[model samples]
Structure formats: C-alpha cells, structure tokens
Target: MHATQTPRQDDPLDVETFARPEQQRRFVAAMHRIAAERAPGSSVRIYVSIAPGDANCERWLECITDDLPDGVELLHYRTAFEGAAYDWDALASRLDGLVVIGRPKRLGSRVHVLGPVARLELRSLVATKPVLLFTHNHGLVPVVDCLSQVMPPEEAPRLKLIAPKRWNRESITIRAALDALRPTGVSNAGLESFRAVQAHLLTPFSAASR
Candidate 1:
C-alpha cells in the first residue's frame, strides 16, 4: 500500500481535513479539549494510526480533536501493516493514553479480535501504563483469551476491552486463533514505557526530582 503521508514535522494530526465541514469542526474541537485536559503544554503528544479498511478511523479522530478538551498534541499515522509488528511502540512513546476504535470479531465465548495491530500494540503498551481498547463488535472478546497465558493477571487486566456487544458463539479457525496468541518477551513499550517503568532513567521522573 502507498504511504498516504510520510512522517514529517509540524504536520497536523488531522493531516488532510474531513469532507464535511461540521465533521472537521467537531474533530478539531475535541482534540483541543483532550489536549487541554491531558496536558497543558507541549509535554504530552497524541499519535493516531489508521489501519487498512478502518472505516471509522477518520470519524473517531475528528471527534477526539473536535469534541474532546483542548491542549492535546494529536498526531496521525497511516499504518502499512496488519499487526503491531511495525510502528506500534513509536506511536505510544509520546502519549499517556491510546484509543483503538473498531468492531470486534469473536472466535469464542470471550475471545475477540478488534484491530489485530491495536491489540498487539496495546498488549505491548501494558508493560508500562494502561491501554483502553474500545470496540462495538461481539467478536472482540477472544482478543484477551491469550492474555492469561502471556502475563500475570494484573498486567492482563491493564489491557482492557470496551465492547458493547458480547458474543456467545465459538467459531474460531484453529489457524486464526493461533495467530491471536501473544508470545513472551514481545513487548512494544518503546522508550516511554521503559522510562515510566524504571522511574529513574538517565534523568529523574521530572526535572524537580533531580
């Protein structure tokens, strides 16, 4: 797939504006709100990634920028891969929270898959802070099934699934189910998580601590 926008400095997180004027306005407002609530200065930055076939990607982002509180430094990225194997950590390093909006597909009673990349990305992020995964599809439950096998209960709990529709069916392809499983030591925390986890890196948590 072609890279819609190459990584650049000073590029608006919205990148290209929405077709609808109201949509664009709403999105910008939300982002500003989030910025203000989350961070008052340039310390916190927001990064968004758009997956292939992700229909609501733009819409959700618009809402975030337009409706959410202000002072949020939101950045947007169009991903080239299906899983979090690419730039997941890079996007997570600068922000405090991540929002993955999608429809979940179920394989079993509680096993679901939202965005494969997002799940893996979140699983990777949990090594540091909490990641909230939101989806409206019933199939999203199984995405957490393998979590029990990877990390301890507490860590797994940090990777949450926000699914409004719960699935009761178990129709998982063996091959597909195996792909959803996460392996050990495969963390995507990036620099930020590491710093947060250690708490005393090259410098202190904040300049004041020094």
Candidate 2:
C-alpha cells in the first residue's frame, strides 16, 4: 500500500509512474465526480467475483483494497456453486459494480467466445453494470477486448481491463475500476473541488488503513 513517490501538486493524478498521466487524470476526475454525486452517507457497493481456492486471485483481492475510495466497499463473492449464491439478479440488484478476477488467458483467437467461468461472469454483466476484468497473469484480458478485437466497427460500453505486472499497478488499476463504477451527478463547478478530494483519498496508506 506504500507508494514510493508522492503525487506532485501540479499533477495530482500522477499517483503511479507506470500509468499514463492522462488516463490517471481522467480516472481521478471521474472518481471525484461520483463521490460528489453519491447520496449522503450511502456507499456504492462493488461486488468482486473470484473463483474459489485460487491463491493468486485471493492475493490480488487483498492488494487492490489499498487504493479504494472510502465510500466504496468490496464484497467477495465466490463463483463456485457449492453452497454459494447462484442468483445473479438478486446479487445484481445489490451491486453498483463488479470485478471479475482470476481468469485464464485465452488459448486462441476467439474473442466473442467464452469458457465456463467467463460465461458466468458475462451472464452476471447482463445488467450492464460497469465491469472490470483482471486476470492473475499480466496479459491481455480477452474478455474486455473481445468485442473490440472481433469487430473493430462495433461499439460497446467502455469496460476497464487491467493486468498489472506489479502490486502497485494492480492497486491503481483497482482504483480505475472503482472510478468507472461510482456514479456521478452533473455539477457546474464541482469538478474543481472534487479533484482535490480525489487526491487526498488516493494518498497511499497502510494496507490496514481505509
């Protein structure tokens, strides 16, 4: 959770050296917008779906928590059906966003196709909630890029996807996902002030913090 370099005041969104400055800036702006628009004292619940017993998936889940906004809460929902809730709609109703973790790298060039786990994840995304796809391996997340790779002319809602090479990048990517999910209301001057709040919340803290 410790960020080696503090963000420069001139560029508050520069939280990580690896992430593009523009992308980070946009991500920060979006996050602040959501916080400002969220109903008072009401949190946005993000459901994190993971395959049970996957060690790597478990680790990334723990690591990503370091950079989450205060109003965001992550709920762990395992995919395996043994004694777990299989009701996607009911779960969807309670969730504002979803993160699908621990996926296999696509073995071939089948973007529109899916496997067992990916299918389950896709079905859950039917509600059109903003989603982010992350795999334990630092490679392309085919699920997010699937539609794009298959048909260049077709358009789908922006789906955030990240496969971080390191823990720091992983946490920052999680922040991007949260920023994409958090809802924002239109405001004239809110952008300027919300930017400051995003900067403060994004400051690195102990993993135990926030």
Candidate 3:
C-alpha cells in the first residue's frame, strides 16, 4: 500500500494554527519521542481510523500528519464495511498502533452512539494493539462508556481516550499512550515535558468542536 504523504506545512488545517505555539511544541515533542523510540532507520506506523463519509476526515488527516515527526507514518483507513466484514486481523498485523477519530452521535445527556463502523475498528484494534481515541462530538467519558458496553473489560485498558476540550486534563494520558505506542529504553523526559506544559495547553481546536 502507498504511504500517506505528509501534509503541507502551509495547509489551513496546520497544527500550528490548530493549537497554540507551546501546545503545538509539546504535541510535536511527544510525536518526536515516539519516533525516536523506533528501531534505528525504522518508521513508526500508526493507523488512523475514520469513517468513509466523514466531512472532516481530510482535516483530521492533515492536522495529524502535520504534527508527526519524520520517522512516523500514518496509515489512513477509511472504515467502509459495506460489502462484508472487514479483515481487521490482517490490518492489525501491519500497524504498530491506532488513532481513532470518534464522531459518535449524541443520543441524550451523557450518552453517545459510536457508529457501527468505527466501533468495529476500535474493538478490533484495541484487542490486537494500543489505540488512542480522540472523541469529537462528546468528551472521552461518554465515548469510553459506549465502548465499555461493547468491548470486554480485559480489552478496555488497551484503549486511551482523549478529547480536545479536555486536553489539559488529559495531556498526561495522551503522553502515556504515545509512550506505550512503542516502548523503548528511552528516559521519562518526554512524559515530564508534557507535565510541565499540560496546564498551558489550553484552547481546544476546531477538530473537536461540536
């Protein structure tokens, strides 16, 4: 399969504009940390999970691709289980980790329904490897609640939840998930860097805006 190209730095969805300078630095640093831990000359492969008809899919792809470091590659997988069940096992074998852009439909207060296609990809990825879920419509808690109903209790820990609105509170969680993406003998400096700036990483971007 062909690799997804790095987004242009001048793109409208640039992470620099999506997030503040310091926040973008921290996020980029975190990405670089992941890239650094990879085996020498090897690239870190992360599967980006999104629905086929999602209007914001391109935005999401561009923003994420812009922030990633040189040694990290994103494999964009548009979930369209139209004809038959997808071969998730085969896909999982090729990915190091998953980044799911969840745009679940809000059903009621504190309730949301993760689309069938996204749910299937999450369930499959979480079972096979680590997954960092970015909830767009609602915050992480409700989306995690939805997943808990469908995902077995044992498989739940493999998933890390994040919401743009709650980035400050969840920055540490995001850092930890990135660390877990590819474990190595690297120091905890990256994690500490996130802690130092977690409070200032305010201003949620439009990607997670309702």
Candidate 4:
C-alpha cells in the first residue's frame, strides 16, 4: 500500500496545542516547504518515519524543534492504509535518519503474521540510515532481534534504542514527551535523566550524512 502525503483521518497532528495558531500554522507550512524542496540526493533530510498509532506517534513528530543541524531538513513518513496501492521507493531512498516511534508487535506475538516484502523494504531503508527508535522496552528488543536477521550486521550499531524506564506513557503530553527526549549535558543525573533523552537521541544523527 502507498502512504498518503496528508495526515490520516484517524489521527491528525495536534501541533496547535503547543504553539500559538500562527506559530503552529507557520511550523506546519515550513515542514511542507522543506519537504517540497527535497529531490533525490539533494541535501540531508531527517524524516520522522512511523507506523500509525496513538498520540505519542503524533507527538514524536511534533516535538522536534526547528533548530536542527546545518542544512538539515525534517519531514514525516508513514505508510498508506493497509491494502491501499502506492509507491515507496523514491521516498525510501531519500531518508537520512528515521525516528521510529511506537510498540510494533512482533511476528509470533500475535496470531496473524505480516507480509515479508514491506517489512524487508523497511529494514533495508533502516540499514542505510541512522535510526533512533523509541518504543515500549519489551516489544522492541524482539523487533530488533528480528531486524538483525534482515539488516546488515555492520550497520546494526547505527540503530539505537530509547525506552524510558520511569516514564508514564499513559499520562504524558506532547510537551512532556519532547521534554523527556531533550538532550541534557554531562553530569551524574543530567545526562542520564529523562530530560536528556532527546539530546542523546540526536547525537548520532550527524553521522547519517556520512
């Protein structure tokens, strides 16, 4: 299935909750503008790739501030609704780093299984870029193990994991999620605390250009 370019009806971006209407409008506009200017192999673009789900998925993309690496642009990537036909190749090749969010079910975790091709394509894309994965701790370890089967061994370290042990996933807001992900400086509590997660998550992104 092809991913739609617009927000899916089930979960629209709630960026307005965090910014003034004008500010939010401009921010959304700027994201699209940056995405529009992109052409294959043109400049570095950091795409927040996702599998569809709850508010945290939306929050993951919303929380990233405009302040980014020099000449780096940000955009969103999501697959089209199940069984909807569309293209994936062009965008897949352009991704520099993918910030994946959500607790994706593993192969044997559920009664039904998934197709191999889409999963393979996604793994291939991940193998080629820096991937910062945010997920429920239990679900992800298995998911990574499964990916290891398909992903190139040499590129494995480039895929980092971030699973907050003390976070309240049920109650956290977009601002809180972003705050929790932000990078904090060196110190005993500072760097290791939830506040520094965002900063640490971004540390390897610059390497994606290589």
Candidate 2, 1-210: lDDT as tens digits: 323245567753233333444544554555456545567435466666665555555456655443444435566544323477677667677776665653344532111223355445555763344455544333212122222212122343222232322324344434545555554453435544554443443332324564
Q: What Cα-based lDDT does every candidate model obtain? A: 0.36, 0.46, 0.46, 0.37
TM-scores of the models, in the order given: 0.37, 0.45, 0.47, 0.33
Pairs with steric clashes in candidate 4: 3-80, 181-198, 182-198, 182-199, 183-199, 184-196
User: Best by TM-score, which number?
Assistant: 3
RMSD of 4: 19.7
How many Å off is the CA of 52 in candidate 3? 1.9
Tens-digit lDDT track for model 3 on 1-210?
111223365642221122344543444455566546667434456777776556776666656544433334456543323455677767677777776665444422222234555566777765434455544432222122122344334543223232333233234334444554543443467535533442222212334665
Regions of candidate 3 where Cα sits further than 4 Å from its true position: 1-38, 67-70, 78-86, 105-112, 136-147, 151-170, 180-210
* Residues 1-210 of candidate 1: C-alpha lDDT, one tens digit per residue: 111123236532221211133532433344344434432222334344346445565555555444222333344443322344556556576555444444333432222233445556666654333233333333222232222223225433322343322223232211122122212232345434543532332122247845
Determine the backbone clash count of candidate 2: 0
Superposing all C-alpha atoms, what RMSD in Å does each candidate have to the true structure? 20.0, 13.3, 16.2, 19.7
